[model samples]
Structure formats: C-alpha cells, structure tokens
Target: MLFLNRADAGRRLATRLTGFAGPDTIVLGLPRGGVPVALEVARALGAPLDVVVVRKLGSPLNPEYALGAIGAGGVRVVDTDAMRALGVTAREIDSTEVRERAELERRTVRFRGTRAELDLAGKTAIVVDDGIATGSTARAACLIVREMGASRIVLAVPVAPRDWIARIGGAADEFVCLETPAHFFAVGQWYADFTQTTDEEVSAALATTRVT
Candidate 1:
C-alpha cells in the first residue's frame, strides 16, 4: 500500500488503534517524521501527544553499525553479545553512549521545549513512528517507555518490513503496523511525498495538540 504522506499514513494507522483510545492511553512520536503521524493518532484517540527521543549508539569502528540505543530518562539498551563479538571495549561503549545521549537531549529540547514530560505511569504508551527499517530505534523507544513505568507498551508504525515482528516483538506488549510488505526496501519508497520533516513542523504539531 502507498501513502500520500506521513499525515495520510497516520490517519490510516489510527483506525486500527481506535480500541486504544482512552484517557489512559498516551501517544509518543519519534522526533521529526514520526511527530506528524503521531499528531494525527493523538487527535483521533484524544490522547496526549509527546516525543520519545532516542539515539542509536553506533559502533566506533563501523559508525553505520548500531551497538544499541539510548533514550531519555537514563534509559540505555546495549547488545552485550554483539559488543563482545565486535571486541568493543567498555570505554568505547561509554564514549558512544555519551555522544548519543547529548543528541537525544538536544532533540528532546527542540521538540518539547519547556513542557514537562507527560507521565507514563500505569498508562498505555503507544509508540508511533513513520516506519521501521532496522527497528533499533523503535526497540529502544519501547525499552525507554517501559523504564518510565508504562503498564503497557504498544509499538505502532505505518509501514515496516514483513519480518519486523521478529526483530522488535519482544520490546512491547502489542504491535500495530498498517503495512508490512515482503519486498520492503526503505520507508520512503512507500510514500508518494516523503519529504524530510522539519524541526519547525514537529514543534508546530506538538503545539497544536497541546492547545487543543
């Protein structure tokens, strides 16, 4: 299935998640692209919208290779087995995490500004994203939401690879994906207009939701 844009994709995804609509359900969008989609979901569900900032901790030797990810509230997820196999030292991991944490903080500020983070305690945290590729970021988001005391975690996305559940199923209590094409290559390919989401757009979306 092809989506006109993130907003279109979000509206479609929200239909499947109507059962989750309630006061206790909170919707969190990954920064930038995910925010627009999540804004629609939050509107449909009448749930508070927030940003879940996370950063992938790339390997020192191979920057493209993620060792794991870090999120807000001191949440960190590391692949110990991969670290050992790659011979990544503790110091290297620490250094990488430090850098990623800095970016995560910067993004959190950019998206939420002075607004205090919404409490997820005993709530159903619905983590929304534009799409899933490697699923590392989404996994980290689930881990972070759990650390924040969410009673239930649902990882939702507009589109993903056919085998996405195998890669990220363990991270959350439930999953909702609109499309999982077997021939998926990248998230952009399924969208008719996959423009990069701007920081201003993200901030505006959040502000609109907060006011309404």
Candidate 2:
C-alpha cells in the first residue's frame, strides 16, 4: 500500500497503536522525516512527542549507502557484515562516526533547544521513523532509547521491506510496520508525496507536540 504522505501514514499507524497511549507512553520520531509522521501519532495518542536524532554513517565512497548509524548518548550500531564485505577499516568507521555524531548533536540542539530530552525511564518509548531501508538507523535508535532507561522500545514505521522487519524486529519489544511489501526497493517508492523533510518542517512538527 502507498501512503498519501507521511501525515496520512502516521494517522493510520496511530490507530494501530491506540492501546499503548497513556501517560506512560512517549513517542520519539527520528528526524527530520519521521517528525511529521510522529506528530500525528503523538496527537492521536495524546502522548508527549520528542525527537530521536540519529545520523546515518554512510560509506565514504557511496554516501547514500549507510554503513551504520550513530545516536544520542554515544550509541552506535554498525553492520559488521557490510563493513567486512566492503573492506571498510576501523579507522574509516571511526572517522564516519565522528562526523555523523557531530551532526547528531547539532540536530538535537536545533530541534530541542533549551528543552531537556524527555526522560524515558520506566516509560514505553515508541520510536517512529518515516520508513526503514537497511534498518541500521532504526536499530541504533532502539538501542539509544533503551539506554535512556525506557522500559520497552517499540519501533514504528510507515513502510519497510519484509526482510528488514524480520532483521530488526529483535531489537525492539514490538515492531509495528504499516507496509511490508516484498518488492520494496526504497521507502520513497511507497509514498505518493515523498518530499525531503526539512529542518524547519521538523521544528514546526515538534512545536505542535509542545502545545498538544
């Protein structure tokens, strides 16, 4: 199934997650694309919304191909198989992490400002993203949230490959994926309006969460 947009997809996802709504539940979106989708979920569930800023550690040669991801609290998830196959050395991986971690911090400040990060301790943290490709970012996100003391981690997304759902499912207490098409090539292919989500849009989405 194709989504009209991230907002539409989010509304549908929220319906499936209604049972989890309450004071104990918090929705964390992986910006900047996930923020738009997550805003709808946060509103529907009447839960607080937060951004989980994670940066993809892309291959030096092919920047689009993520070797892994880096998230808050210095959590990092690397695909050892991908690294070995591509002959990526430890030094290269470290260099990439340094760059991505810097960006991750910048985004955290840009999106959150003076507001301290939401305390996930003893709370059910539902992590949302626009979609999953290799699942590296989502995996990293789950680990990061868990490190922050979340009692449970739920990874939610609009679309993902069936294989990816299986691969990353173990990382969270629950994995909720709206679309798991076998022919999935990229997340954008399943969206009618797959425009790039901007920082300004992300901030606007977060603003709605504050007043909700």
Candidate 3:
C-alpha cells in the first residue's frame, strides 16, 4: 500500500480519526510537512486548525538525528540519553535550542500571519505529521500540547515504525497511526508518489484550513 502524498495520506488517516471529532476537538499540524495532512483532517472534521511549532534540536555534527526539540513559548524537550550517546555538551544543546526557538517563532509568523492561535485547553487535540522516523519531534509536540491542557491527545500519523509508536505510548490519550510494519524502511517506501512537501504547498494548505 502506497500513498500519493500527504493529502492522500491525510484523507485516509482522517477516516480512523472520525471517532475523535466534536465541538471540543481540534487538529494541530507539525508544519513544513504535516500541514497538508492536517488541513484535510480539519476539513473533514470541521474543526479549527493551528500549527504546533516544534523544531528539532539536532546533534552538533549530524543535525539530522534530533537530540531534542523546542516548541513554542520557550519550551524544550530533550533526549538526555541521546545527548550522552552523541557526547553533546550542555552548551551545545543550549545553543541548538536557542536556534530552534528562533525558527519556531519564524514559522509562527509565516504560517499564522495575523490570526490568533486557537485555545487547545480541554480539547481532544489530534497532533499530526507526515510520518515518523525518529519520533523525537512528535514526542516533543505531544508534551507541548499537554502543557496547553489538552483534555486528550490523539497522535495521527500516516505511517511509523511499530517501535517508534510503542515509544510514544500513552503520551497521547489515544494514538492512531495507520501503519506500523516490520520492515519500516521509511515513510517514502510506503508511498507511491512520496514527493517532497514544499513550503508553498504547506502555506496553501494552511490558508485553506483557516476558512474551512
């Protein structure tokens, strides 16, 4: 089974999420990729949309493997063990957090424009992403939303490794991932047209969500 892209993956994921929609429910996208998927889910659910900004605090060298992630309002979630494995100093982590914090603010200004953020407190919030590789970013997002007082959190990802899903267990009130295969090669592997989700596409999806 393969997906066309984020939008197609989203529509499919939305079916599973039908059980979670209501007046007190909302959809939050992890942007630069998750926006398109979240937009479709928001449209299907008739819920308000917002971005939960979380940028990975990467290793000093690789930078792809996330050592942690920084979210809105100066909140940071770290993987202390990962840091130790990489021999990352506290100073390095602090520096990366500062940089990621700035990126989060920039994305907020770009994606939000002048719109006020939706209050997520006491809501059944579904935090979404294209897929999970390391799951660090998603885990961080879950924590940040919890801080916002979300009544229950449902993490909706199109695909993720079973182990990654297990790692995030109970962080969300109910976790909904469409696929968790053993091979778990990559998100692209399960997709037929897993093209890059560009920033322009993300912005357009966000615009559509605003008035939907």
Reference-based TM-score of each model: 0.94, 0.86, 0.87
Candidate 3 lDDT over 1-212, as tens digits, reads: 57888889999999999888789988999986888889889999988788888788889998878777777767777779989988999999998887778878988778777777778878899999989887877887898888778989999999999887677766677778888888887778888777777777766777776643
Residue 192 of model 3, lDDT score = 76
Pairs with backbone N, CA or C atoms under 3 Å apart (clashes), candidate 3: none
Alpha-carbon error at 170 in model 2, in Å? 2.2
- Deviation in Å, model 2, residue 173 alpha carbon: 1.1
Model 3: residues with Cα > 4 Å off, grouped in runs? 59-67, 79-90
Q: Which candidate would rank higher by lDDT, 1 or 2?
A: 1
lDDT of 2 by residue, 21-110 (tens): 988999999988898999999999999899988777788898767777777767777878998999898899999888888888898889
Better structure of 1 and 2 per TM-score = 1
* RMSD value for candidate 1: 1.6
Off by over 4 Å in 2: 57-68, 75-92
Residues 121-189 of candidate 1: C-alpha lDDT, one tens digit per residue: 999999999999988788878878887889999999999998888888688999999999989899999
Best by lDDT: 1
Please rank every candidate by TM-score, starting with the best. 1, 3, 2
Best-fitting candidate, scored by TM-score: 1
Q: Which prediction has more favorable lDDT, 2 or 3?
A: 2
What's the CA error at residue 139 for candidate 1, in Å? 1.2
Compute the lDDT of residue 68 as modeled in candidate 3. 73
In candidate 3, clashing pairs total 0
RMSD of each: 1.6, 2.7, 2.5
